[model samples]
Target chain A: MARSDDEYDYLFKVVLIGDAGVGKSNLLSRFTRNEFSLESKSTIGVEFATRSIQCEGKIIKAQIWDTAGQERYRAITSAYYRGAVGALLVYDITKKDSFDNVQRWLKELKDHADANIVIMLVGNKSDLQHLKAVTTDDASAFAESNGLSFIETSALDNSNVEEAFRSILSEIYRLGSKKALEKGSTSNFAPNATQTIVINPPADEGKTEKAKCC
Target chain B: MTDDKTLFGVSDGLLPGRVVRLGKPVDWASILKASQDRERREKEKRDSSSSISDLKSSQTSIPSIKPKSKKANTVIEESSSPTDGETETGKQRTAARENSSSSPSATSSEKLKQLLAEPTLNTEAVRKLAWAGLESEMRSPVWKVLLGYVPTNLARRNDTLRRKRREYQEAVNQHYDPYLDTKEQSVVTNSSTYNRIGNEEDVTFRQISVDIPRTCPGQALFHIPEVQQALKRILYVWATRHPASGYVQGMNDLVTPFLFVFLSEYASVKDDLSLLKATDLSVFDNADEALSNAEADSYWCLTALLNDIQDYYTFSQPGIQRRVHFLRELVARVDGNLCTHLEDEGLDFLQFAFRWMNCLLMRELPFHLIVRVWDTYLAETDGFATFHVYVCAALLVTFSEELQDMDFQDLVMFLQNLPTESWTNREIDVILSQAYMWRTIFGAAPSHLQQAFQASY
Candidate 1:
């Protein structure tokens, strides 16, 4: 039996950004659909998917925007970062250049995303251990230096894929609840508060889903 | 490199020297002619036994246009009648067909065959006829001519193909083959300079290779190694030649229809092309020269198609941006309720229609329907760019009722994964007809779209 994905206590807009062919799309598919494909096409423009996960006894629906990772496409993909509350900066461990380009992707987030966006540094393709180019300690040190949470994942073999998403969603939830507490607005924590961080509120009829952030 | 750039009139300042070599002008007219004769003989021999049955099957398989009620016919004539004075004969023919009981598909196919059979093809007349739909038997040659890959002059067609095909092969050799050889050799030698050059080329090559298997993954033909190699070479060479845009992802999808259409000319199957399989490689076996010719044609035809919408793939992709903007405005004007519904749901046009504009709805519609849609797109004066905006608006409005019932997530998923799998020619015809009607109405006025169109030109 599937839980009602439509009924959620919160909606978080997360973006997946990285260098081309670093498995950003596969990661999104593996997380949202619980499926993966080695033959997934290189993403063009952007793709969207959503999956609801339980956090703090509440349903947190994750709306993930999978953007094309090519350098040129940033002109278009960056525009989608405006209201995102979280980001997964992914790179293939088998490719050194993708790891090197992590700084550039971080700069892109700084330039386009919200100031409080929770970013996770993901070194994907952990299944390709023999060909690993970016080691865990190196990426971890880099993540620490940049103040970004770090995780290694294999969207191919399902290793750390679930944990990576759940960890980020929980981190975002913690930050949001802390902010709500700071504001002294217990209403914000109510089940139906509907105080969405992004876009306008939903109509009275409730026919349209609210495009929201944490 | 400077000399090569000067020779080719390309002053992009970004091209690498070794990748800029132009093919030496070759006199392959005799070879091409001989091959053409052989192909004709083979086709004739193949067709001789099945010609009658083939004709009978084609006639039956053609989705006959259902005779509309008198009122509907009048509305269609009023709305769809071509306004161009140049297409007077075509207009009369359309009118005559409305009055008569003649099958429009057979008539259009006959008209296309006649136009193509001309010593000097009348391209404008052919476009008018092909806009409705293309005859399966004549689509290959007609598409070549319409795309300008082959010449209008019957005498120059062979020579043009020979030169273009040779140029494509040379381009692959210059840009692709040496890089692969060097990469393999560099693995052993560990030369830094070779590594640098290999890395620069590898970015595009790797992306293309990763995408080739993914392009039309459901279609077995793309899974064949030989077919994948051909597609890779075409995309790589195109990317190399056009460094400004390089290899974009959606381009991989764009190449499929052309490759399939051109390769279909050689396959034993014709009527039900969806039945073509990866095991059908037997047709291409030992036919390297013929296969390469098909590959070259696909390259040039794809080039011709992309040339009109080059901005769609360039840095920033301003072409797609403008078209997406146009779609939003067009939808707002055409169906204000649908537009308000989407806006109220916080569903930006870019969120859903970006793929529609980027992939030319290839991601939305199925393979076969897309080819049929391309018939009108290729026939359009702008080669599917501006007219595509209107088509997208029409498509969105087609689903307005269902879209209004959904929210942002459902709308995005529904639009992205439209229930177009079961769509056939009948549904496509309606979409295209509505698109044409919208273009006719909104295309001429000095509206917002007109201003943008003028600025773009």
Candidate 2:
């Protein structure tokens, strides 16, 4: 089920989702590539990048998926939500409406992503503090009520860009390691196949009993 | 049509005008302010209600950040830190839109924003006003020094910084005060939140749907106005200079930093990655629809740039060849022999420089810092072919000593797996500057750079 590093302690898949101009691509570039642009082209399709991180001597590789945030493109991108352990739901802090659309994104996650997906709510473009509409307190409180992790950062200033990824990677690692421990001894996850295997009673048992009785 | 030479203040005619329109946008400030006030009050009213407006731009109506479904909230809570405080917000942008259409401020701001976005349609006043705003930015010292004119004298730097701060303060004040602001130099803020019915939402939604965020927009010819104009002039120059491949789609992004640099005096503000990407925009056009609208001259200029890149593209597209060649440049700079050694491995070349050649160092560094790297790339485009290689060297600098114990595969993975926060500008500068010095010492540089150094750069 894993590639690249079973030798390592952990691996995580984090998907980045947001509106086109809201800077999801820029945020991904800022995280995976460490680059930002005042003028960034809107994203076209899913772009994935991998980077291994050292967490307390255990190396964790982040399989980061950058998805198109456009409404129509979600049809193609919806397939990407599967198997993801983490999602960085990004929105532009300067644009209030983008901040408001977080619920729909969360719903989309619920519908498509794993049942236990770790979500981080990022209000991007923190460098544009002068033009700030969404306050940190408001976003934080919202996160509190909805059970999502929150951080307001500027991809431009490179603020908290690393911490965001680090926390998500480790969280995924913790979960994956726990799952590994839980299922490592018993083979892989049953996916409900356990019931089918455990009750594989002889189909001819009834026929044999009838023959004996006769 | 305004000629490029006069437009750029270039009397010698090295840069000609693209005659792009500079129209004034309608003032959307009042409506935006009113809406902001209303939103602020709404926040004050509920105190707990978090509106997801950004969602509206990407999603639709009355976005509630809370996932209404328990299954949604459960997955989030169980998976993340109990402290991961970010909540779900849903934008009822459509509702706001309905209300905005009826609001007087909304109508006017929308009109103004419309005027500003279109380069083809404009009133003459708008043109003068547009040029005036740009001109004002030209005089604005903070960004003018973005060209990186750091004064050697601490006193002068302090003076310049102070003067810039004061001027920014004044400009900001003028932005607020209608009377104090000259009609000629009005800086519109809170511009009516772009009053297109579904333009912002549609555009952003379209972008996200296709997974554009995780990928490169491939040279950014669409969004930036300055970039569009720069492509236009380069198109003109290409028509006269290298007409075979003039004005290709991706070329605009490549020239943007140069346009900014050409406008500035010292070319000091270090955002070389942005500068580099801007120059590299001429590589190819990914969006065919966008190409239909582009000027013919621009297409040709782009063609010329692409022609030299024929060899690399013979396999596919030549734009990426620079990624590899530039890797050589970066490695040679870091430890001339080390990069060469790695490259000579030959058989599995992809094993070592795949990431470097792939993302162009985009995956390695912070956004603005990339811009800083681009600033340098713009200045020395030929020698500094691959900008990210410097980023790679910065990440791997410790490798020289630390990795002496590790194998080559580990080295490549370590370089590939490096984190953004690991390196710094000082580290990069040390490598790049050394690379710069190393090259010039061996007679690789043009005399102009030497002259510039002699004159005290």
| Whole-model lDDT per candidate | 0.70, 0.43
lDDT tens digits, residues B314-387, model 2? Answer: 22223343444444444455565555555342212333343343334555555434444554442332323333
The residue pairs in collision within model 1 are none
**What TM-score would you report for chain A in candidate 1?**
0.85
Maximum-lDDT candidate:
1
Per-residue lDDT tens digits for candidate 2, residues A161-196, read 888888877776666665553322212322221111
- Name the DockQ score for candidate 1: 0.41
Looking at model 2, residue B356 earns an lDDT score of 43
lDDT of 1 by residue, A115-152 (tens): 77899999999999988878899999999999999999
Candidate 2 CAPRI-style tier: incorrect
Reported per model, the fraction of native interface contacts reproduced equals 0.49, 0.08
- Per-residue lDDT tens digits for candidate 1, residues B183-220, read 64343235454544556567787677667778887688
Task: Give each candidate's interface RMSD in Å.
Answer: 4.1, 14.1
